[model samples]
Target: MAFEYAPAPESRSVVDIRESYGLFIDGEFADGAGGRIKTVNPATEEVLSEVVEADAADVDRAVAAARRAYDRVWGPMPGRERAKYLYRIARIVQERARELAVLESIDNGKPIRESRDVDVPLVAAHFFYYAGWADKLGYAGFGPDPKPVGVAGQVIPWNFPLLMLAWKIAPALACGNTVVLKPAETTPLTALAFAEICQQAELPAGVVNIVTGAGETGRLLVEHPGVDKVAFTGSTEVGKQIARSVAGTRKRVTLELGGKAANIVFDDAPIDQAVEGIVNGIFFNQGHVCCAGSRLLVQESIADDLLAALKRRMSLLRVGDPLDKNTDVGAINSAAQLERVRQLSELGTSEGAERWSAPCELPERGFWFAPTIFTGVSQAHRIAREEIFGPVLSVLTFRTPAEAVEKANNTPYGLSAGIWTEKGSRILAIADKLRAGVVWANTFNKFDPASPFGGYKESGYGREGGRHGLEAYLAK
Candidate 1:
């Protein structure tokens, strides 16, 4: 018999969700010309709040405000002076960490533990890390007195709302560039909360602005003439569209797109440790992560043992409410995303792969998916080739290390990959042969603000974290 866990729901009273919100332009909340869209809590399908859907005019206003800030205040500000504001913002983020975490869980449908421990902390860390870089750009190997790239237009996805905002806005502001950011339509609450934090920090008006909306709003922002830089984190298809739109423009663009990462396990790998890594890889944040290790490649000799252990571990994963502290898998972000996960999963089954899902009763109301793994999956299968963006893992067997590398590199995505082995030599050797931008040995989904993170090929280009992140906002 499995051990049962009692309900331990995190209190939502910490966050004060307004009934409606407006666009944050020039550091003030103003009415948007575009209509409003209601944001719902996926965990309960309850309407959380309605936020403004920024129109082209709103995008234009935001970009112009950022431009004005850049040219008048932020751009001419000394790097040391700019560092102070960044540090203040970081401190404010730390001060209100719990409220931000609870808001994130409520809006994003991720477990409260993840929002509290991983997302919010990392969001603060990125600001702090980049704050240190603000005054020390000369020592960063980017030449003496590197200049700002002017107004930056940033569009963040819903998976990790505040973290993605921090990733885009922190470095841009630290580098003395003003930013007009668009948080995803579904999860704009945290981004709006971040705007309030900016006010608390007394960040200069127009230095950082947030305009929330859907795809059309994003398009307008990205294509705006006032913005000198464009940073987007989303699907590969949208990334490509942005690339095409900016092809003839002078805008400096960086895109962190989709992935179909592979997690390779050697025969000599620690089964228990590998199982944990595998779980963290694909199921973390309900596998909404772009760089999630969706493919599991195990050495044929120990495939059975690994699969047995992995299934047992999967069975133990609790799935349900995002506010639950014991929940391993939370609700999917939206109804459309849940439908996408379902369609891909059904395709995985129809393509002749054996499907096995964890034994858990999902909530009747919310958009939820249990942890799942597919055995007998081939490289040719749709589940193996395409990005599912869900808590579905496809398992494949490889006879040797060379075959593993080949199978892993076969995907167009080059975001991230994992190698599990006790031997350091094999780990290094396989890592060298892998095509991924990030290769982890015996671990998965680990992130740090001090380290650079990005991808190659169809997965997208440029770095987001660390010293490399500043380059995107700096004039070359």
Candidate 2:
């Protein structure tokens, strides 16, 4: 596949602001209280735009706007009317999907292929799916008539910038709740673009607000007393802080956090198919995926053979410009994330695991890491225990199905796990025992708008995707 740049289908020449971006509040863009921060492209180290940093005062204003919307207009609106707005938003998202995808690729450094195909399409489909549920919440298994929570404070990560926003805001709005959303500081462009979509859709004022800033801004949004609910998707550490911060408050909280998922391959599994699943599990989106199978658990009997095959497959991976459609892996999301991956890879070597990489030339201008594998890794190694959140696979072996199950559940994180087996009985048996939120028997990283997604245990709670996702925004 040759690299190709697909400009947004909408007019790209219309982007107006050259320097600073404002926070979206009360259906309009407004300046932030704190100083301005520059948004940079990790792929080329170029400054894309400057974004307003929302301080405590800005958080207060956004929360007040959200509260007013919930009380005066949004909460009193009929479910059918809310459904119409959601439908409009969905239509506008589809219309501007290409442009959002391009902006996402530039700001987040994910491959354009993923942004175009996976992220954008899913985003549109998510709003569409949830839109239908707005008027039919009675049949969604949440009792006869579930009411909307007052105001929701949502904070999404940078990895799948626009997609995460859609996941958080779509359901929240469809359920008749007003929201104050904060996109990660590094990738605020798509969320800002989404504000335009909301405006075009004629969504009611203060129904959805986008506050652009770093961690402090997120903290303010999450800890605000006026927020009726809090939803977040990011690192486990921050998730814990939010969990603690919202403790004892009436704020209904749900977190989609980190993961150290294991991709287990049985000896009876088809080798070629398993290899493909392995690559897609770990290397897809440069391994920035939350449910990415960072740990490879192979059967001891055929470990040598499988390792050789996996190495050969990895050698062919193309890593370079995210705009290139041919690229298998793109730049890391940021310099900070690159440092985190590097430090953990070094820890893997220091902890006695064997590190290996293919002979691929990386772009000198971008923050890139080759698809890497660490063999001879034990369950005790830091590489195996922690969520590296990069295109690095740590290989370990087990003898029996029991051992595989044990190894897979060894981590504190349990967002998702994978099982590659031909036997139906074995697959069901293993799936039953694994303590993961998602279990992919024959596939890896498969997501659908109708499917429910969230983590169990430390990986965080609350579903994000399916009919169950409505619970987060609904009053029980």
- Per lDDT, the best of the predicted structures is 1
C-alpha-based local distance difference test score of model 1: 0.94
Mind giving the per-residue lDDT tens digits that candidate 2 earns over 365-472? 868888999999998899999889999999999999999999999999989999998999999999999999999988999999899998898999999989989988
RMSD of 2: 2.4
**Tens digit per residue, CA lDDT, model 1, 148-255:** 999999999999999999999999999999999999999999999999999999999999999988999999999898989999999999999999999999999999
Which runs of model 2 end up more than 4 angstroms from their true locations? 1-17
RMSD values, in order shown = 0.7, 2.4
Q: Rate the local accuracy (lDDT) of all candidates.
A: 0.94, 0.90
Q: Runs in model 1 with CA error above 4 Å?
A: none
Which candidate's TM-score is highest? 1
The lDDT of model 2 is 0.90
Minimum summed lDDT over a 10-residue window in model 2 is located at 7-16
